[model samples]
Target: MKKIFFLYLLTLFSLNSYTQNLIWFIENDKFGYAHKTTGRTVITPQFTFAGYFSEGTAVAAVGNHLLSSKYGFINEKGKWLIIPQFNAAGNFSEAKARVQQNGKWGYVNKKGIFIIQPQFALCYDFKEGLAQASVKNNLWGLIDSTGKFIVQPEFYSITDVFAGITCIQKNITDKWEILDIKKKTSIKTNFTRMHAFADSLAPARDTSNKWGFVNTHGNWVIQPIFTNASSFSEGLAAVEKEYGSWGFINKNGEWVIPAQFDRPGYFFKGLALLEKGSDIVYVDKEGSLVFSFKR
Candidate 1:
């Protein structure tokens, strides 16, 4: 019995390490997972929809159509860890995954049990131990993992908290302001639009409709020069110089990758998704093609 238990523990540890290197890939209109380093298909493309692995599990669907399919959680071996039941599901974060049931959003544990019962009209995954949830009327607020409101449900919308900072809009007519989560105070700024804070910076739009990067103090760290921008990730951000051309830029606002792709996504685990014409490809930090999945 002792030898059997030791083998089980060793298997669990190996699976956990393997999951950290998995990335989702699409083939023939179906989704699967692959080893990020070797581009080896770990799980064949069988699910109608699949999400990136988080905390050793991924959300996947197996129905003929996405709208009619049920979502569930799968392990690194492509086995069902949580049976398909949720109307929709999100990747696990902080040991909980957001799931939808009967049109209401809530959180569930790795065992598929509700940690936070379904209540919010809409919700997002937890980041830094806090999540954005909304009650009736679409009023948003920040809630802890236990479903308790850290910031009361009054804002029209609240961005995800990062590095102790977030952006909130009180109403449709109100301008966006930076909220210091630790200090519980708003920093004055005139942000027409803003995204969640990431990598110590947030993408904010100026009055002239140009996007730039801002520090937590609501001050511009990189002036508004790009026609569009995304939040920083892995020390770089995606920006657009022209309407149809996107590229990557360092925090210093210098181009790291030339503006050539039709669309670009933020870097994750040293790879970022880009579209050149009709092909979808992943590129490394230096703009070298890592993998391509033709749609």
Candidate 2:
């Protein structure tokens, strides 16, 4: 039994070693990908613009950024899984990507074939089997993978589905409302401003423009007091004080890091980036500086 467990750990290590690292690296004037840890070139510098790997593919464009150009996809090993052809394209999500053809928008499969024909004026990547799209520039709605409208195109703007619901803005009033696609139910809220739910909480603004955290039920979990608030990351959220200073807080509406810094980045990989004057500092969950770099 001990020998079998040792072999299991060895297999896990071998699998981790085979995991591909994709990091954007610039050379000459083009961008390509390199191993995130080893700094080895995975794809030679070729694309004028390159995006990070998503769904086993990455988006790349070769022509003018300000003018018309073709976009396509590349695999982790630098192979063209889909050659450049579309006028514009976004990274693949759920095996589908929104691409522009002629002057209309449509969804394309991983093989570069249009699964949904170009018809919408604008289209976004699919999320949770639905894509936010618009036939007219002013009205937006959600569409299924087959291009069927799950939600009719009526709102002025709609966010991508999150937590099985989407936040939509009315055409005239610009008021934010939550719509549940599964139940086809809409919940109205009193927030003057709102953002999509992240980590089961969304940043919302009251009538006085003060920001706070709200739960999936649209109830304020943290009172509207901070001048600004961001989505929770690594169990803490960054917030701005009335004096324009920034700090991090725990989910229970308690201050974990004092509001003192001028700028703070979201907690990622067990550390958060912060700026003190011209220096970059990385802080851990306990608010202790783990690393620092001065400019």
Which window of ten consecutive residues has the lowest lDDT sum in model 1? 9-18
Scored by lDDT, model 1 comes in at 0.83
Write candidate 1's Cα lDDT for 1-295 as tens digits: 4334323322222111124567776787688888877899989999977776778888888898777889999999999999999998878888998899999999999999999999999887888899999988989999998999999999997898897788999988778999988898888788888988888899999999899999888889999998898878889998999676989999898999999987657676677766687666778899998877765
Provide the clash count, candidate 2: 0
Best by TM-score: 1
Which number leads on lDDT? 1
Candidate 2, residue 66: lDDT:
20
Give the poorly placed runs of model 2, Cα more than 4 Å off: 1-20, 25-29, 64-66, 230-250, 253-295
- Please give the TM-score that candidate 1 achieves against the real structure: 0.90
> What TM-score does prediction 2 earn?
0.75
Quality of model 2 by C-alpha lDDT: 0.74
**10 residues in a row with least lDDT, candidate 2:** 10-19
Each prediction's RMSD over C-alphas, in Å, is: 8.9, 10.8
Residue-by-residue lDDT tens digits, candidate 2, 94-143:
88988888989998888888899999999877878888899985798999
